[model samples]
Target: MDETVQKSCWGVTAKAVIGLAGVILLAWLVIGSESAAMIAQR
Candidate 1:
């Protein structure tokens, strides 16, 4: 029973980490695209 609870908590933590990483990657992509577009206008 305790092991099951631990596994659930670990899964949740892993999901949170993955979600945060995804958000960061998305933000980087958006910013990078914008910068590239701006440079192309020059």
Candidate 2:
């Protein structure tokens, strides 16, 4: 029982980490594009 619970917890943590990473990557891309546009305008 304890081992199963530990595994479940790890699974949830891994999913959360992956989701957060995806969000960060998306935000970085958007911000990077805006920055590049601004630089190009100048």
Candidate 3:
């Protein structure tokens, strides 16, 4: 029982980490594109 609970907890943590990483990656891509556009305009 305890092992099952631990496993679920780890699964949740892993999911949260993956979600946060995805958000950061998306934000980085958006910012990079915006900067690239600005540079092109200049």
Candidate 4:
């Protein structure tokens, strides 16, 4: 039972990471100029 719970938690975390990455990509595409300026500032 503990192992199954741990696996479920891990799966949720993985999905969250993937979703975040997708959102970041979409934002980068939409805000192309701002993203480029930020990168240049760094």
Which window of 10 residues has the lowest lDDT sum in candidate 4? 28-37
lDDT against the true structure, each candidate: 1.00, 1.00, 1.00, 0.96
After the best TM-score superposition of candidate 3, give how far the Cα of residue 6 lies from its true spot, in angstroms. Answer: 0.4
TM-score of 3: 0.97
lDDT of 4: 0.96
Q: Model 3: per-residue lDDT, tens digit, 1-42?
A: 999999999999999999999999999999999999999999
- Candidate 3 — worst ten consecutive residues by lDDT sum? 1-10
Winning candidate number (TM-score): 3
Q: What tens-digit string does per-residue lDDT give for candidate 1 at 1-42?
A: 999999999999999999999999999999999999999999
Per-candidate Cα RMSD to the true structure, in Å, reads 0.8, 0.5, 0.4, 5.4
List clashing residue pairs in candidate 2: none
TM-score of each: 0.88, 0.93, 0.97, 0.73
Error of 3 at 21 (Å): 0.2
lDDT string, candidate 4, 1-42, tens digits = 999999999999999999999999998887998888899999
* True-vs-predicted CA distance for residue 32, candidate 2, Å: 0.3
Alpha carbon deviation, residue 34, candidate 1 (Å): 0.3
Off by over 4 Å in 1: none
Where does model 3 exceed 4 Å of error? none
Write the residue-wise lDDT of candidate 2 on 1-42 in tens digits.
999999999999999999999999999999999999999999
